[model samples]
Target: MLETYCNASGQRVNNEKSSIFFSKGCPQVTRDGIKNTLQVHDEQLSDRYLGMPTDVGQAKNGTFKYLKDRVWEKIK
Candidate 1:
């Protein structure tokens, strides 16, 4: 699927900045197979994306505290 897209679009994925994310329940063997098949590197997702938290946890306040800080800073 990716191959066809890249072929038709004349654009290829930048492997350097590419990563494959798998569910927590996904087995290591399956993850390895999928990564090998996709020819993409396996990397842990960053805690934040575009300056925002990517995964919200039980502690919502902590996850979003940065926004409050930013707001206060801007207000000041």
Candidate 2:
């Protein structure tokens, strides 16, 4: 569906880097269904997305601090 839409609209979506995320404890059937619907892989909440943590639990652990650190390092 998405690919067809993109084709009709002349817009492209990069499937290689795209993935889907679900809330914690989501049922396996639902997860697999969504994955199949979207034609994308499932990603864990603990995994980082675009250099920032994806889940609130992981955000509180200073996982994103390194991003700020790197920016500051560059500024210095």
lDDT of each structure? 0.86, 0.74
List where candidate 1 sits over 4 angstroms from the true fold. 3-11
Off by over 4 Å in 2: 1-9, 42-46, 56-61
Write candidate 2's Cα lDDT for 22-60 as tens digits. Answer: 777899899998888777784544466666666656456
Candidate 1, 13-75: lDDT as tens digits: 887788877879999999988888877875677877888888896999998988999999999
Cα error, residue 59 of model 1, in Å, equals 2.3
| Residue 12 of model 1, lDDT score | 93
Best by TM-score: 1
